[model samples]
Target: MKTSDRRTARRGAMEQAESGQAAPAMLWRYYAVAIMLVACFIVLVWRVIDLQVINHEFLRSQGDMRTVRVEPIQATRGKILDRNGEPLAVSAPVVTLWANPQEAQENDEGWRKLADLLGMQSDEMVKRLRRHKGKEFIYVQRQLSPETGRLAMDLKLQGLYAKREFKRYYPAGEVAAHIVGITDIDEKGQEGVELAFDQYLRGVNGSKKVLKDRRGYVIKDLSLLQDAQSGADLQLSIDLRLQYMAYRELKAAVEAHNAKSGSLVILDVRTGEVLAMVNQPSFNPNNRDSMNPSGLRNRAVTDLFEPGSTVKPLSIAAALKTGSFTTETRINTSPGFLRLNGQTIRDARDYGTLDLVSIITKSSNVGTSKVALKIGGEAVFETFYQAGFGQSSGIEFPGEAVGVLPNFTKWQPIRLATLSYGYGLSVTALQLAQSYMAIAADGVRRPVSLIRGGQQGVSPQQVMSPGISRHIREMLETVVLKGGTGTRAHVAEYRVAGKTGTTHKVGEHGYADDAYNAVFAGLAPVEKPRLAMAIVMNEPQGSEYYGGEVSAPVFARVVANALRLLNVAPDRAIPMVAGASGSDSKRNGG
Candidate 1:
């Protein structure tokens, strides 16, 4: 009993000491943990304040530099329409493939596939990327169709993306190339009406801010910086139907005659609006690969040549305007040739004596020279000036020529005679057409226009007396009848009136003996003239360099179709003038 009591007392004493030491250790542990938690909380609060308040803008800018981007929004170009609302040029949707060169550098296989799809060499594409290594953006391929672009984008090449764009499309192709013109890859107008009205036809580009992911995928549109404005549609005065007809005929004629080049223009006599303007050796706006300096030229308004016999009618008009001659006036073309100042002006044959009407019908250079000598130089000059010679056509076309009309004040006797018979001066096809247009419009010279509603508020100029104009018109009608030089230009069921011109081209020394410019300018429906037309063939090969043979037939074919298409009423019965003999001769001012 004594030993057990001692052991129990010692154990109780040890337990009481251990319990006191445990309580102090537990208290210290709780205090240390509380202080550590407070320190952590303070550090976290300071960090939040620094980011949200102190360095907020800096942090936000750094983040935005990686994710936000400004991008361009392409605007669509305006359509070029014909007067009848047919589209000559329109914007077609396309896609351009671009790349971030830095990211694309690592994807060789993808790039190879992309290059193959684009019809490009893989090595060349790789070299291009290497050249633009540090650049963020580069064009991989531009102007692909939507389907093709989708196929290209589906490849999922690294750093590659597609951009929407508009490409200019020509519905009529080369038929309207010289008139409607063409646009560059960027949709900027390059030639013709496109160049003439670039500002009105080009649209304003817009911009927007966007958010992108690390992979360069656009996540969301942040904001629009600007709105795009589409360009205004341009309505041209051309009738596409007439343009096609003219182009087909002119091209065929040029090929048939083996001509170096050619041009044709048709105008509305009443409104002065150009109905059709065509050039051969034409380039297709849709086929840029075939374009050349020659094909790109708008020859009708830009090229100049001697007027030849075409201006003889104007010379007679000048004489009549001076009251020195009348429709009944007679001129002796004895021996069919005249020698003045050592220069011999000869006609096709010796039509010994002829009236004013017969002079034009035969296209007699001798008769015209006699008339011009009587009228003096001033009268002829004034008439030519009034008929729009030596002046711009007022159409505002790019590269339009103001032809050479020598000042009559400086003329010698020989010069005056030459000018009278359509020499010693030059004129563009458009100018020639406009001059004839004045005659066709009852002597009212209206400003020529390429745009549908252009040349507004311009008054019609009375270039010749009404009676004289009518008489001239009547005489021109005779030129398309039997025994006339331009009988090939005669249209069926239509009273055709016009002139034939065969001018010698200027050579290194003087007028070339072999080279020539064949031309025909005229109007139709003699009772109420509606259309004025001009056809010019440059350097026709073989035996067909005469205007009557080379150009007049093209005029007849095109006008025949044009008149019918326009629903112009037939004025008279068909004339049997198609078989009329020899064309106006090159040696006879034909």
Candidate 2:
């Protein structure tokens, strides 16, 4: 065979074998590639369907959970202002430092550096952090100083946070503490005017959805859940200048007399606004590190006393009201004492025969007893009830004490006599001041107000005739005469009408022989009175314990200064001469 022919024949044999095996392998490869392409297409379609319809909301929610959160937006608390627009209780936005325990633990030095900025020891912070090991949130410090808060933010420590919040501050400090009261860490009012009008002072908190970082810091705001609303500002009736004057005088008198405590209230007779209400032994509301319950109380409205002779004018008003007696009516009290139903009521001495004005001028117990016997106990009780005794003054101040005024049916003969001269009953200093307001306002019982413009009307709720009120007021004027017990209460540039009260402190058993409550309630510039006030000194320990010696002086000093502050022109040309002779007695009686 030729070589070329043999090679060609072997190549043909090899080609035939290769072609037969290659056809089966190519078909298998085509089928396998097609199956894989179909599987990938089905998988891609399934993933798209699941993500678009079946689990869209779930995935979106999961993403949001890692980023967005709702955060509170703090609202500014309302400001409390005096009638003259002086700031009393004010709220300022402050920075509070907070932290996340877990995040802070991730950076151990973060808390240590924060401690230095917070004026805290690093070791102390370490213990606090360890104690809150499982806590996601903790307060590093609340209400930080501006400088301290700025420095803390500069550090940018891990897990550390700051939020804007309100903190209440009082500018008047202890001077107006009792009336302005105090607020808590969350800016909630806790006492005085703050508590009384808390709803108006505290604003609603708002919130918004935000995106936060891993360290729990807010980064992006999403949407507002609610809009923040600022609180309404409160305009109080208090006159800060007058308040300072009243506080100064009351504090002086209390200290001079060595009394346990004292209360003073100054009211605008025409408007029924409380110009000044002060108490001795007061607390600083700005910081209450060492507060006492007794001192925190608004004693003028909260504490009660027998009132003693201060109620005499009320008795006289009743006398004039019922037409039971005229101004000329005389009571024979020459014996200086009255023996009634096994009880003896004595004056300091015999006042002889006295007309209505003279009776008040002398504060004669015998004369008052005779008048009560004539008018009957019911008439006197009705007069007191109408004058706002045994009930609230409508100020609605928290913890206000409504004094005890027994019904006439419960009165014995002796009780009636004592009631006529301010015994067998109790009255708060504020209530007494309200009673005087009726007289000052010309028989109109004004609604007492702490809020500015709170007076709805200047009319009487319950009233005696104007003529009757005027007559009684005249009789009270005599009580401030030289012969009157409250003669020391006479102001230099203004005529004063007031009664002095010296009641034996009611002990657990009965009236104590030694202890006394010295009280004076009155209106200044007797004609067209501008201000009415009440002064009380409890358990005065000095040699002079009478209302004339203790409380009357306070009323005179406070009213005199307050009137000057108000720029009230002097009504009288001649000053009230001190120690001028009239009908004042040696030792005044209740």
Candidate 3:
């Protein structure tokens, strides 16, 4: 064998062995790649299963957390209606302009257009936009009218947006200001009836989670997060017609007499429903630009003053109820003065001898003091308490005052004597009106109601005997028909009965010099009493600041108009009387 041939054979054999190794390596590499691909496919399939089934809810929740949103659904406030179903206060649609200040600041044209539509200076708007650039949400303006809001939207200003809202509006303005009350910027009740019935007036706020588009617009409806409940409506007992009439008369009288302040309240004698309550210098609840503590005060329930001679009827009634005297009982009131417990009691003028009717009609301070002495302080105090003094009327208002009526056991001799004719104590106009209501309703005392549903199960209480109340009613009628104090309060078309009070203003030390509070309380249609009223004029400036001069005229006008407005048939055929010149000519100052 040749060496070349042997080498060639070995080389060929080596090449063959190398070829065999390369084929196996290539096949192994292919198999490994195939296994890796198959493993990756298996992992992908497992991940799909985990995400679509086992962890489906978790992924869905993450997606929702990133893209879903919830927003509040505001409910409308309840409506407030008068007794006649007239809308006194209502909610009207409004819009609020908001902005992403950072975005707005960068768009000068947009900012300028927005400023123009908002009635704001361009430079000022730019400054404000710059100031709030870091804030995510900023309110540019609120409570824009529908027209203005539409204009703003038309501008399509960058980052500027509008949200729909409801604003409370008072249609009657100041005419029913104190009665209807007012709401706050967030549509929440702030004062008056609004505050009193806030729970019923304020609706429940609901919410919803919705899917939105890229432009932040809500897409299809989603799940309801919460349900909204609308507020309940309120129907008050106030008669709008009577209220207007009373307000007009009270305003006129206040202007005529130059009174510092005045208040008038009318009540339904049978049901104790307050038909009209008015105070002068009232502010419009809608505007509220000129509102202050003084104008917002409800004097009918908040203010207190000495009742003076107006309290005489209560004393006389007490004496009569005790079987101490009758309408014809006589007492010696000559010299117009009497002394009891070392305190002297004096009348406006001397009346030597007068019967019970004459004594009450004349408003004799001396005669009333003598009668009170006979009735005793305990009885007088009890009578005043039973008439609803020294307590709230339970009306739904925030700052009602319980007027002072000192205990009889704590009264000194002078205090007792002064209290005989309405002094040394104080009472609100509402309290005085309630007293008259007691007489008009034949001795029953009903709780005053502001709401229309009759206040649960409460009923009137019999405070006095019917016989005594009738007798007192007759005596009070004589006061208006032929009396000394209530002559001007008599309405021509109605049989009226009332008492007058002209009390000196008390200072820190004692009574002020010459300053007086004139008050009058009365009822109309004495034959079948329907309404009772009380009026008070604080610090009336003029020579005729007596109750008969300053307050009675207002009372007569209010009663007359209220009766006509309420459609109460006139009980008497006499022409409507005015001033102090009537059948009764009592000059007692209340």
Q: How many clashes does each candidate structure show, in the order listed?
A: 1, 3, 19
Better of 2 and 3 by lDDT: 2
Candidate 1 residues 301-339, lDDT tens each? 998888898998899999899997889889999998899
Candidate 2 TM-score versus the reference: 0.90
The alpha-carbon deviation from the true structure for residue 540 of candidate 1, after best TM-score superposition, in angstroms, is: 1.1
**Model 3 segments beyond 4 Å from truth?**
1-54, 102-105, 339-343, 574-588
Among residues 3 or more apart in sequence or in different chains, the pairs in candidate 1 whose N, CA or C atoms overlap within 3 Å are: 502-590
Candidate 1 root-mean-square deviation in Å: 5.8
lDDT of 1 at 424: 85
Tens-digit lDDT track of model 3 for 1-590: 89999999999999999998899899999999999999999999999999999889989998877668887878889999988899988989898888877556464587787777778898888888788889868888999898888888777766777777888998878888887889998988887899989989999989889886543545766889998787888999898888888898989888988998899889898788888888987988877677877898788888889889888888888887788688888989889877767766777678788988878777778788877877789989988888888877767577778888998998766677789788887888888898899999999888887777545577677767888888878777766654456677777788788877888898887888778898888888787889989999998897778887788888878888888887889885544334445322224454
Estimate, for each residue in 30-142, the C-alpha lDDT of model 2 and write its tens digit: 99999999999999999889987897987789888998898998888889999989999888768899877776764468668888877799899988877887998999899
Question: Candidate 2 — which pairs collide?
Answer: 483-583, 483-584, 484-584
Model 2 regions more than 4 Å off: 1-61, 457-459, 573-587
The TM-score of predicted model 3 comes to 0.89
RMSD (Å) of each candidate, 1 decimal:
5.8, 4.5, 4.1
Tell me the TM-score of each prediction against the true structure: 0.90, 0.90, 0.89
